[model samples]
Target: MKVLDLQCAHQHVFEGWFGSEDDFHQQLERGLVSCPLCGDLRVEKKLSAPRLNLRAAREESSATRPEGVTLSNHPAQAELVELQGRMLKAMREIMTSTEDVGERFAEQARAMHHGEIERRNIRGQTSAAVALELLEEGVEVMPLPMLPAVKDTLQ
Candidate 1:
């Protein structure tokens, strides 16, 4: 298996593993690779340092080892799970605190921007075109994946 470092258009860096360089290139060409953070498909390969395995030749120097450190074989998995947990918690907080404006997201946002309505936190569904238009108009908005329980339709 080959491990390679990759960065998306949004500059979110992550590692991908493949059977070979050809496999990686094939996946990239097929648009199968994407950024986990923002789901961006425009990914680029990054230069990575080579790893050498000499475990059988010599034991790790005790002097250089960190004190009371225990390493996990699946460190990446643990970190990923923790990060996901934190992200979910933040998303939950936002969903709970924001008003569900349903399908009138674009209208409400525009009203707030034009000072026709009071500015407040809101969550709702909007088309990609609408979101782009809002951004182009200098209205700050973020596209967040809402949890099923936070569906604006029920609001």
Candidate 2:
């Protein structure tokens, strides 16, 4: 397996695994590769050094470093990446657990809130005005940015 660093037009960095270089190219040509954050199709491979598991070297370096000090040169970038991963994980969980009510989001939410329909987890699109109206009516609702990549399984 080949792991390659990729960046989309939106500058969201991610990793793609492929059987070979040709396989990666083939997928890119077919528009299968996409940014997980924004679902942008314009992706490019980034220069990345090969990962080496040097446990002894890591141990020696850690011994010299103070406790609570991180090894990442770009700490902010590392934190951002970690945050993005967490957001993606939470999004995946929400997507899997909720029923997509589509444009009927407001109606369904209202119905469930008033006990007219069975309460259940749901997700969908609604205008800002409608969402506010729902909230005013005491119907709990939250907006979730739906990325195209989240709507479909990534290759």
Candidate 3:
């Protein structure tokens, strides 16, 4: 397996695993590779160093390193990466748990609120005005910004 660092046009960095360099190229050419954050297909491979399993070196470094010290040179970047991962995981959970009502979100929500339909977990697109109206009418609704990648299954 080959692990490569990749970046999309939006500058979201992620990793891609492939059987070989040829396999990666083939997938890219076929438009199968996309940004997990925004689903952008304009991806490029970034320069990455090979992974080395230097257990003794790691143990020595950690022994002398200060407490609370992270491995990343940029702490903020590491935090951002962590946050992105969390957000992606949460989005995936939401997508899997909620029923998509599409543009009929408002209608369905209103029905459920009025006892015309059963209340259940749901998610969909609605205009800002409609969403506000729903809230005003005591229909509980929360806006979730749906990522394009979250709408499709990622390879």
What TM-score against the true fold does each predicted structure earn? 0.50, 0.76, 0.76
Report the candidate with higher lDDT, 2 versus 3: 2
Write candidate 1's Cα lDDT for 1-155 as tens digits: 99887778966556788999999999999998877656688999877546556663224632455543323213554465457547756777897799999999999999999999999998789999999999999888999885443332211
Which candidate would rank higher by lDDT, 1 or 2? 2
* Model 1 residue 34 lDDT score: 79
The candidate that achieves the highest lDDT relative to the unseen native structure: 2
Instruction: List runs of model 2 lying over 4 Å from the truth.
Output: 54-73, 151-155
Of the candidates numbered 1 and 3, which has the greater TM-score value?
3
> Which lDDT tens digits does candidate 2 get at residues 16-132?
999999999999999999888998999999876566579987788779987644453245555667787888878988999999999999999999999999999999999999999
Off by over 4 Å in 3: 60-74, 151-155
Please list the Cα RMSD from the true structure of every candidate, rounded to 1 decimal place: 9.4, 3.3, 3.1
Determine the C-alpha RMSD for candidate 1 after optimal superposition of all C-alphas.
9.4
Clashes of each: 0, 0, 0
Error of model 1, residue 128, in angstroms: 0.5
TM-score of model 1 (CA atoms): 0.50
Tens digits of per-residue lDDT for model 3 on 32-74?
Answer: 9988898899999987556667998767766887754444324
